[model samples]
Target: MGASLLPFQVVDYFKPGIFPLMFLTGPLLYLYVGSLTIEDFQLKPIHLLHLIPFMLVAIHRSTIQVVPISSSPDLVENPQYLFNKVYYTLLIISAFSYWFLGLQLIIKHRKKMPLYFSNYTGKNSLNWLIFVLSLFLIVFLASFFSFFVNNILGLAPVSYTTLPLNLTVFTFIMVYFGINQSAIYSREKVHSKLRHQQLSPEESLPKSGGALLSDEQIAALSALVKNYLTDKKPYRNPDYNLQMMADDLAISRHKLSHVINSGQKKNFYKFINQFRVEEAKAMLADPSFNHYSVLGIATECGFNAKTSFNRIFKEETGLTPTEFKQTLERSTN
Candidate 1:
């Protein structure tokens, strides 16, 4: 990006073969997102394979810059021109492909988050990164079109300033979010914790658990979970999560997630939020709770944030918590 910001004469003099380094754009992005969003991410020899494209293209461009190994006078008939055309097209395809794959990684990782996380937080949500990627993709597409017009068609006007301008805006956005966005997982702590707790692409089933749950076992575990939730009302705790409930129930987190998903027909987050919403509904109607404000009622009902509580409440009942309370008030008056 810095290279593109400089004057052509300066860039060519100082960094002639920087075009080939463009191949690194996609690989580096995918590597960054993958490390954050996925489990078991580590520096491995296999990861170096992503660099091969960059290395090959860089070497080819460097040879041509120094030695001018091949050249043709005819514009269309030139082999070098044809290969360069294919090169630019492939660079665009490669970068876009990695961007799309990074999007998929974020999505898949997010779906699994609700299985363990009962409430949303920055750490649990990558929607901001998704927004970032969408902007990057748009900028990238625009820049590619600009490249095709100015350099490929030998037209001078459109592509000259737009490419750098797009990069400059995108750089600012990346910096802004990079500074503001919280880390999804700390590598040192999360890697070790994931290995112990085991939240991978694989199903959240048991490893040491041996045999799969029989229908009878599933029913028994399901009953146990339901009975405990009803009797103890652990869902009333604002910070409660699958792990906490799992520990209280003397079940592994994996088995707890599996039971809730299979038996209750909801992810852990939705399953717990359902209970909280029901509790809020009861309190909304009960005169004894009328003294509490909606947020106070929500806090007592296990919601850490009023926004989450209201959203979840509306999802469960067609009315917001305030609206629900007003409905009860109107009926009484």
Candidate 2:
């Protein structure tokens, strides 16, 4: 609809009132990233407020079509020129703002991931999102510049012809990812705090008033955490996370994070996955577990997805699961 409106004069007979759609891109982007990052995010009545700009633009365009306030003398001299200018300007602003917001959401989501899952799987990771939004930022900037050149500067509007093509490319990219990318979270998984706990500001602070613990204290905590993992094998649970570990040890989540990040010099996920990887290696080496396939061993070692299991295992051991199993068999012979 929006692409069809680019050659406005040629399509005038079609009555394509799609200028309002420009306002929709931003809000939809903001909501898409929000849904990915925020577990509890849901569409509310308040979210409708984001569409107000589109509604007003639609009304203005409809009014111009219904009432001929001035004769059509090219696009500039027409009485509806002011409305067109406002719509394009707002479209640029809206795209830039939403793209910026989406980038921030992705950054926060990346930072938050290490605290929860041991492996950043395709389903939950935002690499595709980051790529899509970065492209959106580029397209939005190009569109903004094009609008400035054509409308504000009274230029030849060469860029206007390319706008629809750029949008087509963007749409194709989005469709490809939408079809290939897995869901970030299922409905049941979204509400599951077992993986990620939404902590309050106060809850994220340490008991030591945000002061750094002594080296000895940190080392002791690290040792305690390691011993706990060895004895209890919490990583055996696919849903295990920092919050669960903290609760099991009667410590705060922040303190556990500190111990893992500062003391062990690793994020919570890597620290936990180290144990899981070791367990997988043992199971792969054991002749008794020969009945278990590579994926079966991964599942037994607390991995929910075979792809993530293979990736993380290779990352930690510099060998794929099958190759590692082959080496084990060779050594036994």
Candidate 3:
């Protein structure tokens, strides 16, 4: 919409009333990212304030375009030039500001993933969002630089030509990620609330004189975690996580995370999914379980999604589930 207002003869038929619609991009992008990270995110009445700048810009442009001016040929030839300069400047600032905010939100969401989720694969990891926001910041910076060079310096008008291409690339990137990226918090709502309830004031307090675990204690806790998983098969529970394991072991979530990170040298998801992949392999290889399909075996082995099962299976073992099953069949035959 903002592009249509550029000083191009082909877009002359395009009206200039809604030129400020470009301002919506920043707030809308922020809102979209917020909705993805925050479960049940609602539009508060306060959020309507974001649209005020757009409304003011739109009103100014509408008045300028409608009001007759006899003296200035600049106004007659290109009335939108001044507006475009201001709009593009604001656009760049808005884009960068919101992109930074979105990036921070994704970082926070990623840090919180281990607290609420078992499998941090795919959408739950939020790497896609980070990448998108990073790319958006880069594009916005380029746009701002281009606008500054063309409109302010007046050295090379061709610099402004790249703005449309930059926007097009941005659009394609957003659409591609939008279609492929799954929801980060789709399955984490209940767990998130539960985790909030589990938090204690002591946990948040500074440990002034709290005893630190010795190396031996860490090793023992790691061994116990491994043994518990092997004997009890808690990984077979789809909802199993560090917090759940900590509760079962009668330890704090922080200690369990420390043991997994320092002793096991893996995150909670990797450690748990490793066991799940092993279980899936065993299920796939067993002739007695031949009645189960690949997805059935995945579900039976505590994988919520077949894609995750396949991805993790391949990551752990070089072969996919089907290939592993085929190899097993050949060896048996």
**What TM-score would each prediction reach against the true structure?**
0.74, 0.64, 0.57
Q: Model 1: how far is 119 from its true place, Å? A: 2.8
Sort by lDDT, best first: what order? 2, 1, 3
TM-score attained by model 1: 0.74
lDDT against the true structure, per candidate, is 0.71, 0.72, 0.70
Model 3, residue 52: C-alpha shift (Å):
1.9
- Which of candidates 1 and 2 reaches a greater TM-score? 1
Candidate 3 has its poorest 10 consecutive residues by lDDT at 66-75
TM-score of 2: 0.64
Task: Give the deviation of candidate 2 from the true structure as CA RMSD.
Answer: 6.8
Clashing pairs in 1: none
Instruction: Give the clash count for model 3.
Output: 0
Arranged by TM-score with the best first, the candidates are 1, 2, 3
Deviation from native of the Cα of residue 163 in model 1, angstroms? 2.4
Candidate with the greatest TM-score versus the true structure: 1
Residue 181, model 3: Cα distance from true site in angstroms:
3.5
lDDT of 3 at 212: 64
Summarize candidate 3's per-residue lDDT along 80-169 as a digit string, tens digits. 465566666677778778877877777787877765577756566767767777777677677668657666455564412555566667
